[model samples]
Target: MDAFANRPLSPDLPERHSVHDMLVGAGLRPTRQRLALGELLFRGADRHVTAERLFDEAVAAHLSVSLATVYNTLHQFTDAGLLREIAVDGARVYFDTNVKDHHHFLVEDDGELHDIPGSNVTVANLPTPPKGLRIDRVDVVVRLRREEG
Candidate 1:
């Protein structure tokens, strides 16, 4: 089913006043599930969210969005610079609301993400890219495991 079909291009927005307006600013067409998910996502301080975790939250809010929809929307949002994607591990990925340059800490036990300021690390000794390409950005993830009981 088309999750965005017939959904409002404008809904009750979060603090920014209009989630639809925000989506439009981000170049996304405001669909129902997208608006709902946007409200859930952009309503507070910047943070990270995984598709599975967002799916759980959507379900709890009685939204009818499927996990696939969440994944697709997240990718779309990332492509539009509404969020940033980080591959924490081979099997784990996260979307960060703060799109600026920065690093992260991955909590192993709970799979949570914590921001590490951009100034905390420096990259050096990078090989040159091909003639047609230039470096866009770099990502670093620090993993943490809890102390055993």
Candidate 2:
């Protein structure tokens, strides 16, 4: 893990309070686990993380949080629009903090994610929705594999 990944919590900006504020802003009640895990998710730079990776980081940080709590918190964050869930593969889900309209490039071997700026792609035409249903949004994910030399 990198240094920032393992850095200690800032006393002035504790995870508990940060998570509480985030939840409150998103109209969610700040539960104990939610607060703890949300700090882990939202603090520092934006990332593409999995539940397992989050669990490991929490444990390393001595948060005493459980794996289930990580998943639950992630789901809540997604619901609250604080985190964006990307379906990169059948068995794995990646969370991103860049919630704006954009796309992703998934590195298959390492599971790394890269943001694809929206301006780089153009969608000039699209099929209209039928009936009363409306299009909420569109997501494009480009899966990439390392080319052998």
Candidate 3:
């Protein structure tokens, strides 16, 4: 199913208002660019996206935002606890709309991500943290590929 189906692109925007309210709740000013970008990011089921992909979507939707703006805004949202930043590898980063604690399945062939419920994974013993340090969070990205026929 299309996750971005039926998104509003007109003047009479209920979703825009909600996105505005969300920005305010997150202690961020609801600028025109933010509202537009937030609407695209938050208007559907939780999913993952890269900055380049989001910028492409914005361009496809005629949103006048630079790629740098998208990157900065994504980092801002992550810092504000509205999104989660997942670094799959050194070169690839995905911004997840679901901020809850959970793992992910990375499809190697297509670069798709699927959420793995936190309850399903178990972390056993771990090496003790060095002095003056503690474990913050555990992020597991299980890579997957189709079996050969």
Candidate 4:
């Protein structure tokens, strides 16, 4: 159990103070744009989102944000360890709110992403890295689709 373990995964957004504190803790200056975007990203439950999807969400929420700004902000958050970047395909990328090490399951039909517990997958028999390079982490995305009947 940890400090964040108590926060419930709900539909409601977290208090602004907490989001502000999170940005500060991440060594980020909580600017107006960041605060608004952070509120949407950090609102309730660990989930995955693409930059375009997030931009649409911001627009739907009546927040005056640009798509480019959304992409830049997401990259910043990932760099600050506030989120994780998952590249499923060269064309599709997802920013995960849960920064913990874990795998994912992608539903092909619905294009939904679900988290797989870190312990659920086993990775073994890895080739040694090059002389100076080291393996930081391995991300596995299991894609699934319903069988044709």
Per-model RMSD to reference:
6.6, 6.3, 5.8, 2.5
Local accuracy of candidate 1 as per-residue lDDT tens digits, 18-106: 66776787668899988999888876567799999999999999999999999999999888887899997789889997787799988
lDDT of 1 at 78: 87
The lDDT leader among the candidates is: 4
Lowest lDDT sum, 10 consecutive residues, model 3, at 1-10
Looking at model 4, the pairs that clash are none
| Off by more than 4 A, model 1 | 1-16
Ranking according to TM-score, highest score first: 4, 3, 1, 2
Candidate 1 vs 2: which has more TM-score:
1
Q: Of the candidates shown, which would achieve the greatest TM-score relative to the real structure? A: 4
Candidate 3, residue 74: Cα displacement in angstroms equals 0.4
lDDT of each: 0.82, 0.77, 0.83, 0.86
Ordered from best to worst lDDT, the candidate numbers read 4, 3, 1, 2
Off by over 4 Å in 2: 1-16
Candidate 1 whole-model C-alpha lDDT, 0 to 1: 0.82
TM of each candidate vs. truth? 0.86, 0.82, 0.87, 0.90
Pick out the ten consecutive residues of candidate 4 with the lowest summed lDDT. 1-10
TM-score of 1: 0.86
